[model samples]
Target: MRNKSIKKLNNKMNSKKVIVTFLILVCTIFNIGAQNITPDSKVLYKKVNGDSLYLHLFKPEISKKPTAAIVFFFGGGWVGGNPKQFYQQSKYFASRGILAISAEYRVKNTHGTSPFECVEDGKSAIRWVRENAKELNIDPNKIVASGGSAGGHVALTTALIKGLENVDENLSVSSVPNAVVAYNPVSDTTLKGYGSKKVVGRETEISPTDQVKKDMPPMLIFHGTKDKTVPFENAERFTRLMKEAGNDCELVAVDNMGHGFFNGDFFRKGTGNKYFNLTAYKTDVFLEKLCYLKEKPTLAENIKQVSCIGDSNTEATYPKFLQEKLGENYQVKNFGKGGATLIEGTNHPYFKKKEYKNSLKFTPDIVLIMFGTNDANVKWCLDKTRKTKFIGTPQEEFKSQYIKLINTYKRKNENAEIYVLTPLPIYEHAKSRDPEIKKRIKHLYDWVIPIIREIAEEQNVKLIDVNKLMKKAYKYTVDGIHLNQKGYKILAKKIAKEIK
Candidate 1:
């Protein structure tokens, strides 16, 4: 009888010890003051391997409805990297009405963890987001995963390679994201690939390229052909396999760009990272295509901002002339990008450039839009002809995008005056620098110019005919497409007089 009593006493004491230990661990691992934590912060999200993982969030300024979300992981070959790698990205996506998060994971240098732990943490972060979606005001089904290099591999793995999830995480909620966007990811961790060394024995298990399956979510990849670190071929191989498995994957091969090409350059140099801004814009396009965003962006703060929007011609020469004439009080700034077509979905859409966003941010009293030069380039688009770099056609995309761009400015300032300019006549000749421009000069006048006129008439806005003004001034063209300084001066003088 005494022995039975002792056994019961021992069992009860052991149960109490276990409960006390569990309580101590809970106290150490979980943030007791979680309510005091910021809305999107270094949240002690995942508890594993006796460590806590954090993720920072950038939520929409006004969350009127449940919104889509994107989570970013930073890359450092599993040795290092932090959440801040995508800080600018998160902020940009947030401004566009999506919940953006930059997640922290176990890295080799910091956590003495393997790639397996990284994957586990990555999965946990996604699971956490879904688990708390109602409170975060996020639509659980519209989550997207994106990252650069190794971080990209982690994001990709969340969709492709599975089963490395943390045991404590809720498995009922999917770790898989609805869409994936990778920037020069170390996607293939096979023995033949660069990242294979990091995972060592478990390369095949974590390799996204090896795990391609049907019914996978849509994916967008921007990999530089010149990327020597991960080899542009890795992304191509993964994309090829993904397609073969009947998955929707779009690979944007960036020519002559190296690894980490999407990183913002502000910290390195004072100038904004054009590459970062462009990629972020492209991501926005991708999400919009999926109908995932809560709403389109609108309005901003400003001064006596005069935003000059256009293609390469407007980039430096003519905008400089306009700026010089306007003087300091007008604050005329050129937000033009080379090879920019106003049509959306093209490789070089004006909407994809940082200049476009900056122009809107300028909150100008007067807006000058000088496009149609690139839009008229015959080889660019002809209803999915597969010959051009642009994804939009002049007929379907030009007029609508023009109206949208105009409305975007008006939203910023209802009183803002906008003027549309017709492109100069293409002078194809021996001196023309661009062969395509010379060869396809006919399209500009035949179709693009007439369309610009139609939009100017229908939209009931001010029209400035730079082309008709210089129809006989072909000799002033530096290229068949772009104008020389003398031609720009004529344009500037004309614009200055009209606006005045």
Candidate 2:
């Protein structure tokens, strides 16, 4: 069950990245094609370690560069794992204006005297980043190492362990990271750790927390409540020891979550797990604390205040955008119901049926609407041909039902502005939908735009032409329908621009 939850979290995180990145990459490619480049850029830096170890670096293109850097190591039990495990880490940090490097280390199978080789590689990557801090426009003093599972062990060890004499022959640089951010790291090198004896040779010398020093860097650890693989108590014990030794350390145990909570089901495909993706939430907290940035996020405080209303697009839209844009100003309420249409009345199957009840209660200053996407689908009866038989026709009835929903908002808060957004284009070759369906989605602009315009005119509210905005930022969409990071960013900017 724990594994299932972690897998779910991994998938959840992956789904977010795939959607966001596709949108951003699409826009980036189009921009580059047009000699227009975005502020975000990534480059692959290869360092020779007998063979080349590829390090993927994500950085903003802005002139005043990052004040910190995060070097991430991946986990696959030390024998088989890739750098991509930190996909969300790289993107999350980069989105926050931190230079994030996802470093690939030599796995045990192909290259290494022991897991220590992985540590050496991790250390070298950190040193390389610091050595090139000036060129990379990073602050060397702010470099940190972060990872999960075996990767976490590597991060913690590289930070706490004093010498790398075994792998020193392979590198000419320091093996220390300024700070350590470990997610469920193996602090004790006993038989209890997954394959600990095989890697570290049954020695107490390998335990990281057991060797704390006054010079030890500040550390943050995130673990899950039900994490059986690396028991939550292990992390607690490690944190306790760190504090006992007068070293700076903190531990967060996510409620009802399990090991590898950084990712949700999106990463693991269809693994049927429900882990909370604690990494996604905790990572933001980690970085905020690391930089000593004043706007520290408190989950207990924010969860109660923020709500969101969206569709699948909401996953990419409100949560991904508004959370970052507004920061801590307004609590986000997510009402984004996937595959929901306005016309279904109280019995509407998806989120609409449940969300419509509280719509009046929230009485938010600004109500964001991105309802047209799923409504454009044949399933929701918004398709130009063959609308869902139960939901009525696509264009007119759909528009009327949406208007009625909006009117309720006006009744509740006369001063609140309803932002109407047009649906983004669909992918040209989506397997889920038939060719006709795909074509209908691609032509969403033809039908939905006019209806949205009419609604905006009649209501006297703002209309964010996301479809038009997204058209200019095309590369971010996978098949011209689902958005990637670039697309979400464009939409986010449009929404943020209208607000203040």
Candidate 3:
């Protein structure tokens, strides 16, 4: 009886031990998942209203020394807005090897403050970022100020306007960013533009467009043509003034779109993703151009990739030259198949090829599309039978198809920077191949190149004017249609200039 009691007690204790171990494992897993899902954030300042303003920080898992940083302010017309508005953008920049921050500032709803106070807080946040650059492991010189709508005004104020500095901030530390990315910003606060009533006494004090300076940071602005709250002309006027002042500013006007179109949440769930994705992708390209980011975008394990999609031209030697030019920092893959057309069900359709599938699988950070050479073939475009099978006119079909291709890659990787390449021009002699080839050359120059240019413009993706560049080097091509080694070298140089 004594031995039986002892064995029973031992079994009960062992059961308790197992239960405890399992519970501990479950808790550990949950904790790790929570950490991964939630980013690290901290309070940067405490206001007189007893509310703490926090900076939600998203630091890259892997970063090179002296990392670049981008700070975003939320838009709410100085009435109300949440730092969460830019969380997605911050997360994206963090993944690209930059320290990204979404800062909370004083707003009318919580602090009962005016736009001027908001501007002061904006400057303080930037100053804090600059002051703590060492602690944040970021390069102060590469800081980028970014925001949307009212918040965009704050961002611009950091660069263009002055005198709204916080008393506690170190005046020696500059709040101005090396670059700016603004979305539908209320750039003009005068009587003609947004927030005119709010800035009644001090119109020019907060008007970014009115304060354009010669040495302001390079800026990229995204605005909708149909925005009512902030007129589309505001963006145009601001960019024009910046350019006139000898500053670089790029304005991307989204057609038929309205206010707050840059934000995904502005539309119904899953509806406005395209606008958000394109804007984010363009910002990445702009940052890369400024040399703020490394040559290639940082992916998991520090790997970066570039996927080139096209026809014989991309397949021959350009990809190799690109690989050499990019050096060891990138995995350059040529997904080019010979005699491939951009259109589906065409002779040697590229969309149906394995290279296309491979390119999608690669999940590249940068995609270069150079198609249209084969699609412009006279037999493909002018054939009555083929034309009958096509979904629309050659130009319409081409535009829709190119947009489809861009959206496909964008869906695969929203961060990828897609570049559309114009088909290279054929030399005058190469046009003599046959009646069909001569007609193809004419179609390429007359119909195809213009169609691609229109698509690029409409889609708002960067266009590489390969036709224009190749025209200058047509002498390097042996047959006018295909480029020789010398021609490939020139092509590579131009591509490198654009991408690198």
Q: Which of the two candidates, 2 or 3, achieves a greater TM-score against the reference?
A: 3
- Off-target runs (Cα >4 Å) in candidate 1 are 1-40, 267-271, 294-500
The candidate that achieves the highest TM-score relative to the unseen native structure: 1
Please provide, for model 3 over 1-500, each residue's C-alpha lDDT reduced to its tens digit, 9 standing for 90 to 100.
12343343323322311122333222221111111234444545435457677777776654337788998999999999988777666766776678888889989898888999888888888887887776666898999999999999888888987788866657898978889999999999998899988878888888998899899999999999999999999899999999999999999998877887666422222222345556777888899999887664322112256788999899989987886676544556778999898766576887788888888866677899998888888777666577334577877777777888899999887878889999888755644454567677888888888988888888878899998877877677766678889789789888988987
In model 1, what are the clashing residue pairs, if there are any?
305-364
Worst 10 residues of 1 by lDDT: 28-37
TM-score of 1: 0.54
For candidate 1, give the lDDT of residue 462. 84
Order the candidate numbers by lDDT, best to worst.
3, 1, 2
For each candidate in turn, the TM-score is 0.54, 0.52, 0.53
User: Which scores greater on lDDT, model 2 or model 3?
Assistant: 3
Off by over 4 Å in 3: 1-37, 46-49, 265-268, 296-500
- Residue 189 alpha-carbon offset, candidate 3, angstroms: 0.9
Number of the candidate with higher TM-score, 1 or 3 = 1
Candidate achieving higher lDDT, 1 or 3: 3
Least well predicted 10-residue stretch by lDDT in candidate 2 = 26-35
- Which parts of model 2 have CA positions greater than 4 angstroms off? 1-49, 165-173, 200-202, 264-266, 270-278, 292-500
